[model samples]
Target chain A: MPCKFCSEKPVIQLPNSERKLCKSCFIKYFERKAIRTINKYKLIEENDHVVIAVSGGKDSLSLLHLLKKYCQKRNNKIKLSVLQIDEGIKDYRDISIEDTKKFCKSFGIKLHIASYEKETGKTLDKIKKQHKKTIACSMCGVLRRYLLNKYSRKLKATKLATGHNLDDEAQSIIMNQFRHNIALSARLGPITGVKKDPRFIPRIKPFYFLTEKEVATYAYLHNLISKFNECPYCEESNRFFIRDMLNDVEAKYPGTKHSIVASFIEVLPLLKKKYKNQEINSCRLCKEPTSSEICSACKVKEKIKS
Target chain B: MPKIYLEKEDKILEVKELLVSDILKSLKINPTTVLITKNNELILDDVKLSKEDRISIIPVISGG
Candidate 1:
């Protein structure tokens, strides 16, 4: 089929829109859609310092490239920096760091690499060994999120951007629903649904509308060098199951993921209203925003130390 | 023969003209876990390959 936008042959058919596009046109369409999402959500503003949380993976590399393109094309005075957390997994993160460095250098963006060992005095490998009962992903996720927020704030970033695409968002929504965690579901959006606080940098997802397939295709089309290695510690997570199930459904019904996100968006205002008065406390140990006296990261740190 | 560049293994394979899915099946690779590209352009499963094409199979990886 010919590309709907150009004379070139179509290479892809977007799931939600079913619009067939060729290679170059697909790239343009992907970037333009991301820009629209950013504008629609007011994700960025003038002179905003945006810190991207990159994992040296396809989604993040594509996000960084697209955001850079957006800034250049629109002449937006936004400073972009990269923050990568080293989970200290053997062979996994070690290799990804090289891809991260190469991309950051090529893009001329500043990168700050933080490690779990530095932040919590224990690498994931050591933590997994010591705390055999603890889920690796659960521990890694809490620590990575804490470090990303802490470092982004330290770098004076006005906003923290992540590479979460439509698939991730949809899976998260379904996962939260399956777990019956409405409060957590309330926190999912283009921008975080949390109340504004000085200590917390608002997290934004520029690729919130694009599917994982689209993001991967974009990365490949751009010839971005990225590590496709799965983290050694991630195999046992429930998210893997959720991801595969969603992908299966999406394969049969192409726009199912989009519908999940769209349904969440429709009810988001109500969810926000329901959770608007929820109280947020500061962790007694780290003084970070949390729901209890001690934050998850601090709690994990205590476990690791013991 | 079309050359298939396996990005995960950093190796290339010579194969005959077939649907992208068949090529992956013959190689015992799961289509869901990896993406196929030809000349740097993504190729869907049903797409037919040609002898002149250079394909790349890239693994899909992301953090939750």
Candidate 2:
């Protein structure tokens, strides 16, 4: 099919919609949707310092590329930097970090790298070896998130942007529903965190409405990413199963993923309101914001050390 | 025969002429998780293949 806007050959047929767009038209649509999402949610503001959490993956790199383009196009006085957590997985993370560095350098965006070993005293590979009973992703997620927030706060960033897209959000909503984790579900949205403390940096998803395919296509078109690398520890997590299952259903049902996110967005405010009054505490070891005295990262660290 | 290249697996398969969707189905790959390119160009799922066609399946999903 020709592009919906022009006679050029089409590049992608947007899921859950009848419109197909060619290379140039699709780029415009993809960027426009992100700008609209950012403006609608007030994810970024003037003079705000935005720190992007990048993994050297398509989603993160695409977000980085789009934000740079967005800021330049509008001439917005937004300070942008990049933060990448080195989970210290051999072969997996090292290769991606190199690509991320090149990408950031191309745009002159300052890139900061943190490591699990330096901060937590062990690499993720070592932790996985010692804690055979625990899920690697869970452990990595906690530590990565902890470090992201910790460093973003240190950078004095007003917003932390992630490459989270519609598929990620849909999988998260379903995962939360499956586990009956309403409190965690409350934190799922385009812009995350319920009551932000000075220590906690609010997270935003600029690609909230786009699908993984669309993001991948955009990244490919712009040559923003080097390769598609799946984290070595990812396949063992609950998310991997849910992602495959969701993809299976989506193939058959077409718009299933979009519907999940759309419905979740409608109910997200109610979910957030229900849990807004929850208490936040500082971890005795690290003094980071958490629901309990000790944070999840600290808990994982103790597990590894024990 | 049509040839299918799986980028993630770094493997290739020789298959019968079929629609892109059916080829993915035979390989047990969810169409949602991949993009198909025909003769070095992107194509939609409904596109049919000929014996001379060379298709590449590029996986898009990356677990974060």
Candidate 3:
């Protein structure tokens, strides 16, 4: 079959759109969709310092590559930097950090790496050892998010960009619904955080509309170096289950993932409106934005210390 | 015959025209865990491939 847009030989058939596209057309379509999402959401503005979170994984690396290409092609004045969090997982993080550094060096982007051992004095390995009841992913998730926001804010970044794609976003939405966390569900979107502050950098997802499959294909086609290894400490969290379940549903019913994200986007404004007035205060320990006197990171630190 | 190149393994398999899903099945690989590309472009599972096509299958797993 020929490409839907051009007469060139078709290469891909989009699951949702069912539009067949050739190599160059597919690349253009992918980049254009991402830029469209950014513009539609006003994710970034002129002269914005965008700090991207890179994990040396396909998604994040793809985000970094695409964002750089986007800026160059459009002559965007936005500055891009990379922030990598070393969770101190012995082999898993060490290898990826090296890959991240190499990619950053090749791209000529500045990279800032924050290790849990330095900031919290406890690596994820140690935390997992001490807190046997807690999941490694839970601990890593909180610390990674806290460090990303803290470092981005310290760098005076106007926005933080993450590698979250359609699959991740849809899984998060379904997981939140399963957990019955409406407030958290309110926080899910292309751009996160309902109440924004100067100290808190808003995160933008450039791959918000693309799926994991699409992002992986783009990364591979671009020959981006990414470690496909799963973390040794990663357990089957509810998210894993949700991810598998959603993938199954998507396979059985094409466009289900897109619909899930679309419905969430449609209702996001109302969710934000409903939760907009929630009070936020500074954490006494870190002085970061939090609803309570003490933040989740502080609480986790206390657990590790005690 | 169409040839599928496994990028990570640096191996290639020659096969007849087949749907991407069927090709994956013949290789005993899970469809969800890999990305199929033809002539350096992504190919969906439903897309049919011809003998002249050069395909690459790259294993991809999900993480945050």
Highest-scoring model, DockQ = 2
Candidate 2 lDDT, B1-64, residue by residue in tens: 8899988888899987588888877888887788888866788888888888889898998845
What's the C-alpha lDDT at position B42 in model 2?
81
Candidate 1 residues lying further than 4 Å off, grouped into runs, are: B1-17, B21-33, B50-54
**iRMSD, per candidate, in listed order:** 2.9, 1.5, 3.3
Tens digit per residue, CA lDDT, model 3, A38-89: 9999998889999999998989999999999888876869999999999988
Ranked by lDDT from best down, the candidates are 2, 1, 3
Question: DockQ for all models, in order?
Answer: 0.41, 0.72, 0.35
Candidate 2 lDDT over A1-306, as tens digits, reads 789999798989998888999999999899889999999999999898999999999999999999998888768699999999999999999998899888899899999998999998888888888877788888888898999999999999999999999999999999989999989999889899888778889999999999999998898788764555677778788998999899889988999999999999999899889999999999999899999989998888888886
**Candidate 3 falls in which docking quality class?**
acceptable
lDDT of candidate 1 over A87-195, digit per residue (tens): 8888888888888998899999999999998988888898889888888887777898899999999999999999999988998999999999999999899999557
Which segments of model 3 are wrong by more than 4 Å? A7-9, A74-76, A225-227, B1-20, B23-33, B37-57
- Interface RMSD against the true structure, candidate 2: 1.5
Scored by CA lDDT, what does every candidate get? 0.85, 0.89, 0.83
The list of candidate 2 runs beyond 4 A from truth reads none
Give the TM-score comparing model 3 with the true structure, all chains together: 0.88
